[model samples]
Target: MKRFFLLVLCIFATSCTGGGSCAGKKEVAALPDTFIWNLYSDPKSIDPGLVQENSGSDVGVQLFEGLTEYHPETNEPVPALATSSDVSSDGLLYTFHLRQDAKWSNGDPVTAHDFEYSWKRALDPKTGSYYASYFYIIKGGQEFNEGKNTDGNSVMVKALDDVTLQVTLKHPAHYFPQMIAYPAYRPVHRKTVETFGDKWTHPEHIVSNGPYKLVSWEVQKEMVAEKNPYYWDAQNVRINRIRFLLIEERETALKKHLEGSAHYTDDIPTLKIPTLKSNPHYHDAIQLATYYYSINTKKKPFDDVRVRQALAMSIEREKITNVLQQGYPTRNLVPPGIPGYTTAKGLSFNPEKARQLLSEAGFQDPKTLKVTLSYNTNENHKLIAEMVQNMWKENLGVEAELYNQEWKSHLKNVEEGNYEVGRFTWIGDYVDPLTFLEITTTASTQNYSKWSNPVYDDLVLVQSGKERDPKKRFELLQQAEEMMLEQAPLIPLYHYGRPLLLDPRVKGFYGNLQDMHPVKFAWFEEEK
Candidate 1:
């Protein structure tokens, strides 16, 4: 312990300065290696298979590694645990050559069998992982998830050897390599999970193959992770410790940032974006996420296409954009800037047309029907819901009720179709349009709206499989988007862009659409 302290002091004292701690470099460096980050709220779960939102994903990414990962800067798929891989001539089979030196935090060898066990565990109906639908591209994956096939042999995933993983896809999927980078595909140590049971996700028993390992978790207070010595690429890891503080209030997090208590934060208030933009450390990145209202298509009056379109057209999205002041003012499902694909344009703002459509949908006086807008408790979400309420009242003389639920409850209610219109946002798991479009498929478990469009389903699922040309496949997806918009089951609002106040002390920070921060390549630098 004395030697470790002396080593940290030596690096900090000599590394000398830039970013934010220039004047206090010696004092800052004399302490233990630590990076303080902010978490807006409690993560739903640390288990990779159960994580569905960005809050959980951020922590999950640090504690686990999949077959591959998004390149820090480019957001492109790159090898991580896998040393090399090969694809069959038909593009249906992928054989991954795992790195033999990889080991979990508990010193267990990370092998193909670990992946086999973890993948099958996620697909197990008992696990109830919503993202398991992501693996449907693999042969028999859907059947396994639906419990139609209990035998493991029916699944396409196989461990041919200790270091080789073979996968057979239902059809050619060019983006399959990138898709594997998502947390649902991350491997868990079979022995660790079996021994610890539900406690396996606790910091004490958690075993991971990522660059860092969980050291302590204090629930709604904070969690800490230390560098994993057993990690295959541990030599390249620079940061020694990362501390995540669970802070719900944006103002509280910002106050901590100003006091030098934190080095990174994504919880800053949207209203502060304009003021913070002048600061050098203030950062903004275009995220592949959309904040939209999930209209329950199974119920009235939202069941009618015209009624849904009317409500969508009535909302003045530009007013919301002015407050956000980051992402694009879009009524699109897919965010812009995706390579080789155009975003889906749903409906435009026109109060006159909205009223006309509302009347046409059999509601002469829209105010006669009261609808509920359910959302999680957040300052921004509450304010947006208020804005929407006013918009509906002024444009169509409609009355809408607002209900605030906790994160987990909100998700359950949305998925169960318990509300008329619910607030929802989807951050892409991968850089493909399928990440955005697939969720709206009739078959997707993440389809909160309970919307089912048979023709729309075929375009994304059936046709994309048969179309060999990538361009043609994307076009088919585009047609699907157009068809879904024409029906208007989903009311598009605005795209999401993250505004971060990052401390210069934390060097080598890379921001992308996914907003994934891999701390392995990050290090502390003296602030200039």
Candidate 2:
């Protein structure tokens, strides 16, 4: 689950020069001796509290660790830094036993104080953490984040001793274990953070407790992670180091792959996909995210649900998925197989319904109804935007302006309220539907659309607290989803399915719902 932007660059000039008996092919760079993986965008920050997208979060997984980790094969929570934990009978308090051998990259012993400090830092209003919603379950978390409390002393997070940690929550959450697997819940060294201040994210300043340590960082070039010799599980880790190359140029990255310059390349261009399918090296993987466009509810015109519904109904989702996405688009907001995801039904393309709704909203002259739709600067995003632009024009008789920006700028615009309609996608941080649906709630910092409804918010809040009866909880969540789809808060576009280039020599590699590229246990084999 990488958050990358689409960057368009001037193609390198290539020519075919033929001698009397042979043709010359384009020359490309040779592969390095190190294991290199190409990324489309550089992370804005490796700090878990500041990261809002998957790409940044995944990289954080290498440099940080929480009390728990998710087993990708089972999608179940397991111990990472914490050795064991127990819950109280009331289910509001949890006590954890830290790993005695755990140590930070700087050789500092890991302790419950580290966890306590990290949690409080995230909840502190001054920290400006966008992912603090995950900690709302802890008692006083909401109050602390809202500035109603002076400091973390009032919060439920506490260090009982050097190895024992205690936590108190507002209610019992069955999915609580799963939530901590994400980086936002990871422990940070208080000393390192305070020492570096604003420059904490730089490679030289960061201290990690995970399986790897930051060896070096060259912005827009490549970042290196070497094996952490002090890691508690260092004996189990095989790879000495992993090289992450920032390859913003898609064609160049592909050319490098052809020249054996990188071990992995993600998101192959649509034009080259067909020819690569028959190649032995080709591998396809499904991404657990849904791509869609959102209209800013705080803004005019979009302030009307009728306009939102009309806009949603106008687009022919089938054509977009079939033609633009090559039949990989998913219409529903929550991807199937996740909890609370029901195959009940969804809104379909109805030009007449869209036009009538638009007319009802007093936009009969489709020529006058114009809105800007924002998209990232990737080749696939451009194609999808062009298709949606055509659909809105033909169906609703409205001219929609296509606005494209770099991926980072596009995300910033959405978060900062610069775009009227923003293109976005969210891979689930966990397997629950709430992970996907709850972000749009009125109070959620991730809710870029400004969609707020008391009824919708109440149901989600209630479900989050209820720990018994999965069926009943899902029923309430289903109702909330129906409400969201009916109002058309955002037009659900399609589910993601990207082809991965899995090396034949590599094994134990699997695609995750979060699009996590887990290289820890993956290894190459020599055939006998």
Cα error, candidate 2, residue 311 (Å): 0.9
Identify the candidate with maximal TM-score: 1
- What do the candidate models score in CA lDDT, each in turn? 0.80, 0.74
User: What is candidate 1's local distance difference test score?
Assistant: 0.80
Give candidate 1's TM-score.
0.94
Cα lDDT tens digits for candidate 2, 1-528 = 221111221212121121121011432132222456777668777887777665577678777778877554444566777777788777777888787999999899989999899999988888888788778879999889988888779999899999999898887766777788788988888898999997887888888888888878888888888778888888866666767777777877776665555656776777777776665456666666888888899888888888888889888777776764343555577878765557335577788998888888888898888899999888888888888888888888889899988888898888888888888887777777787778778878778898899888888776646646677777777778778888887888888776655444444455455666545555544223
Task: Name the Cα RMSD for model 1.
Answer: 6.1
TM-scores of the candidates in the order shown: 0.94, 0.90
Error of 2 at 429 (Å): 0.9
Residues 1-528, candidate 1: write the lDDT tens digits. Answer: 011001110111122122443122334322337888897777777787787887777788888998886666555667788766788888888888888899999888999998888888888888988788998898998899888999877888999999999999998887887788887789888888889987888887899999999899887788888899998888878788888888888898887776667778886787877877776567777788888888999998778889888888899898887876766777788878778987666788899999999889888988786889999978889989999999999998999999999888998888777889999888887777778888889879988777888888888888888889988888998888878776777777888788887776666666667888777767776555
In candidate 1, stretches whose alpha carbon ends up further than 4 angstroms from where it belongs are 1-32
Query: Which window of ten consecutive residues has the lowest lDDT sum in model 1?
Result: 1-10
Q: Using alpha carbons, what is the TM-score of model 2?
A: 0.90
lDDT over C-alpha atoms for residue 227 of model 2: 76
